[model samples]
Target: MDIMDIARRKERPAHRVFSAGFYGGSWDHDVRSVLGKAPRGGADVGEVLSTIAAVEPHDTEAWPTAWIALGDRVGAVAARAAERGHRVSAARAHLRAANYLAVAVNALAGRTDAEDRLQAVFRRHRAEWDGFTAQSGWDVRVLDLPYGDGTMPGLLFRPDAAGSPRPTLVMVNGSDGSISGLWCEGAEGALERGYNVLLFDGPGQQSMLLDQGVVFRPDWEAVLTPVVDVLLGRDDTDPAAVVAYGISQGGYWLPRALAFEHRFAAAAVDGGVVDVSRSWWAHIPDSLRKAYDKGEKEKFDRDMALGFKLPGGKAAERTWAFRARPYGTRGYAETLDAVSAYSLTDALCARIETPLFVAAPHNEEFFPGQSQELAAAVPGAEPVEFTAAEGADRHCQPLARELTEQRVFDWMDERLGR
Candidate 1:
């Protein structure tokens, strides 16, 4: 059986998280055992981007991770692209790749260069978005509000006219999520089970990351209010009933947004995150510590030098490198520090008085302690913290459709009295 197959068949959360035993993400589990401090001189930029540029676009994982490492060391992979005569589009992509990496590496590590790289990526993409869009019908609209800059681009999906207003589920996508709004196994499963869905890139989400240079904010309510506003105005939407959900890193973003914009009648989440910085730092996994903490510059060199053999190796290596760096570490840390004062657990418990449903993998490797903390906060929240043995999938919902969608949405139906 394949690794995922074995993982699904087994009944352990640890098994689910370690299903990657078949993958190289473990850094062979030994390479990271080493420990030490970062070198003083830093990394080499030109060589890093040059190495990254050699990789293809579809290889999104590896490239970004390598870029993050390089950025942490030398910095300015974007500037390298510009210096190399990469076109405007390529330059922008390089920067976005860097942004993608920054996110992967977690917070900005309190570094200004990291923030600059991320902002540049977001800003450049926003400018490019001016003439390149394929949205149609009610799917694309201008949603303006009182926060930040007022007007923001948004896409809305309403229930088909064939039926009365249905329960609308607002999908608050997590960090740098896709702008295409294409449903993945993570969420498309929910749509099939009789739910009116509206997928949008709120502030600090993909749309903003790619344009507006607005990155994520501690106050996500600004985004949610306008979304609720637009939904209520739509004829096909049931203004009295709504459900909200966030995923991945979104566990934090979605709950915060719902806190102030408490229009949703219900809320849900998958593999959520709490204490973003700690979680981002911990994503490195216990296995990969040797090469990093032990200060094995040579092994580190191999990880970056080859830049292809690392985890997320086959995909956009440069982007993956970036994902491993500022985006994941630095940006994540910076934002975490900024929002450290706010508690998603507190936010949801106090503000989200509506019924809540939680779908979380008990043995989640990515973001641990978050679901438990959130579930613990609010009473009467249907906390289905499932283990792999008892019919739960990790990160995304890969369970029996009848369970994840039908049952979950059915609860929404019951709540809405539809």
Candidate 2:
């Protein structure tokens, strides 16, 4: 979805952590990088306003980066307005930039010293964390699982439900964020519903990049199996009802996890890889098709490819640039190239007994007919395709969020006999 469209829909008064996802992926890194770039060219009021508008972070850390990026110019505007005694205009600009950035960049769990400061501002301003408020019945702990020569962090979020070890949802996070990503709308919803949610930051997830120095991998299920053992051993989770759900990148991930390990009770995958390369290409929207067709962009594709991986393949950095950026991977072309080996369509369909939920968007630019693609993969695999248009909110449909949540929980509930 267009970043501007998301900004208009949220209609919040300030920048905060909650809005970070609106910026797309990597609110922490993107805000810092974008803001760092804006000042060199910002000449007058218009430039400053435009610059602040450009960095669109997908989450909370964007706010501070927003302020810091144009802090001098913004302060100058405010100061000039103040001298004229137009305090209202100056305050409005400051507040608006700060407010949006609060939700844009990720300062809450970020490493910078400003994390605390930014959080305090958000708590003081935004009122409360709208996503997750319940005291975590189960704590979220990150575990480092050693792989071939490297490792990825596994995040286990235990449910606080008071019962004989409830079912566990090993939430494989998307490619962009780290394990803390369990804080998003879907994962948080699962946690609140009393399921033990295990968020994994396997290859390419934030923790792997920042902490473990790992990049994305196609053989993600390999990473998941070990973590599954950890979750199974927990006193709080029902070993037999271990269901796995993948969203976005997780879509590719959870399927591979299931493909390798048949133990999961059921699987619910949304907006996942119909076929790796095809779906990776699908991440790019229709708007950029013309530019790509014209061969005008290289950077965007390069970043995507660089970070993307195919099963049993390597994650190479993008070899070129793209005009319009895909939210998560910067290397569009490279990612797509790696995804070219993509053929999850057949893989997911192979298992009919595995109750699968495949959600499709009405207007996917790259991989149109995702649900159909997924459905094609799993012949009778409980397909949940919806004709959803890209909404005023973002790329993954918020409109689909509610229905998707209900159908998934209900389906899993039936399968697990909960």
Candidate 3:
């Protein structure tokens, strides 16, 4: 039976957190992550909803405080469990604490002294996660990849059954996700399938952007080439069956990398993005669009700055401020230039010789129609779609992750003979 034909929820709950606007990316994602982690003792759904009820939409200041408080409470539980030598209980609590702290850190508006507490708290919880994983007997190791001048932090997870070198999955994160977060996103599923999983933070992702000060670059191939080289050099990886998966903005990055780096057996994207600037431009008001079209660049910039300062523009302010930091741009105008340059030309897509799997969710808001457009551009690209009817319609299939992983790995298994 066709997956899209399955019936699912048609409407979003009206009172749901951040249902009305684009605040701190997506509040629905925050809520979903919280609820999703409940199975792992990461959250209490009722308590989370109660906390959500206290904060107004787009309230970044209040958002972090509420989540962090809950995270701290969970951290205490983890500490007590650790003292009692309850390894399983401690690990579960630690993982949940780390998840909550991640959401708080991610919601931060910009890089400032005010964000230091949130970042520090997140770091502490992440450490707790590391300690828990070490005690839990999971075949996971923290490693740093050599990059230009500095190293990119990563985690390598080997399946428990170890004999012959297995098909390894190298996963690259999107614009805002952490290496730890990607585990929940797909690494856990990949490991369960007996594939060694490597989750890395490239330029503009987590530590690289926040700590290393490595800004985003349009030519993602430059960043990924070194990653591929390092992973292939590892003994546990099967050179002939290695596959790369890119999520969120990585959808664009992975495809761009595959165009030039042909060592990979295959590449897959959770969502495809052809041109980021075009999508950003679409979100701009028509008045600003007219100014840009009329060649009044300075006027357009001024109006954009004014828009953020106006009433009820806090969400816009927070979003742009967070985006600009990754590019090290002084302001939104320069950020736009950086984003505009990030486009996968049809010529470039046609150069890719590797098998490509493109997953397109029907209800994607950020980059609608992009997956199909990319599929059409790339020769023999296998384009698949997740529909609202199947309840996997949102970006990256956050709610239907198991189904997403199943479909993606099934495709990879077939192509790579795993």
lDDT of each: 0.49, 0.52, 0.77
lDDT of 3 by residue, 1-418 (tens): 1232122112334454333322235676767656655643456667677877787655667888888887788878888988999988887777777777777777774535456785686576577667567656578767888778888888778887363678889898888775556777777778778888887778877777767778888787787788778777877888898898999889888899888999889889998989878767876898888887787878888999899788867677776776677778875566777788889999999999989999999878778899989999999999998986786776787667767878999999899876
Residue 403 lDDT (model 1)? 50
The alpha-carbon lDDT assigned to residue 371 of candidate 2 equals: 54
- Give the TM-score ranking, best first: 3, 2, 1
Cα lDDT, model 1, residue 72: 34
lDDT of 1 by residue, 276-381 (tens): 6565345344433456557554564454445456665443343344343323323322333454533565646666666777766765655666777776776666
Off by over 4 Å in 1: 1-22, 26-147, 159-164, 179-182, 185-194, 283-336, 339-342, 345-348, 398-403
- State TM-scores per candidate: 0.57, 0.58, 0.89
lDDT of 2 at 377: 72
CA lDDT for candidate 3: 0.77
Return the top candidate by lDDT: 3
- Model 1 lDDT vs. the true structure? 0.49
381-406 in candidate 2: lDDT tens per residue?
66664553323122244334555567
